[model samples]
Target: MNSDHYTYRVTWSAEDAEHVGLCAEFPSLSWLAATPAEALAGIRSVVADCVRDMSAHGEPVPVPLADRRYSGEFKVRIPPEQHRRLAIEASEQGVSLNRLVSAKLASGA
Candidate 1:
């Protein structure tokens, strides 16, 4: 797996008082540095090393999020009352429940 293809994020850690780099595919791995660039570089190097180690050990390496396929469909369970409320809201808005829920999710609500 190419570490470059993996999803990476760098953000400030208030508790650590430094920038923190994170890889979505390797949730347990992180690198803290004084700067975002250093943090990102550190995390990338760590991921590359991990990938190499896993490969050498005959372990399955994770597919990069950028290279993975998503179906765009998933099931979510909510309480019956909440479901009924959403259904009514959808009906009042003249849209399907899926559409209403999709809008809400897209809005980050």
Candidate 2:
């Protein structure tokens, strides 16, 4: 990553109410979780273990998260008629419904 460009977010969560844990995932990076806060802190030390036993010789190391930018997910509801119309337009344009909607919105449709 260019350090100026991309960002990823990983919200920590326990496996269950009784457990303590942290969870993290990124689009272009690896995923990991810890049973305790200390386990998460141990990432740097344990990363070497993952690399040492790796089948590939040139594997990269996992670095600590430095940025927290995120495009959070939200729900948008549309009437069935509107959805059908968007789908038909998308099919006519040889694109997916999402692509069509994105294009139309970007074009002030």
Residue range 1-109, candidate 2, lDDT tens digits: 2222223333454553332222232233333554444444444234434445542566553442555445653567999999999899899999998878887878997
Per-candidate TM-score against the hidden true structure: 0.95, 0.35
Checking candidate 2 for backbone clashes, the offending pairs are none
Query: Model 1 over residues 1-109: C-alpha lDDT tens digits?
Result: 7889999999999999999999999999999999999999999999999999999999999999999999999999999999999999999999999999999999998
Off by over 4 Å in 2: 1-68
| Candidate 1, superposed: residue stretches over 4 Å from native | none
Pick the lDDT winner. Answer: 1
For candidate 2, which ten residues in a row score worst on lDDT? 17-26
lDDT of 2: 0.51
Error of 2 at 22 (Å): 38
* Colliding residue pairs in candidate 1: none
Q: Locate the minimum summed-lDDT window of 10 residues in model 1.
A: 1-10
Q: Superposing all C-alpha atoms, what RMSD in Å does each candidate have to the true structure?
A: 0.9, 10.0
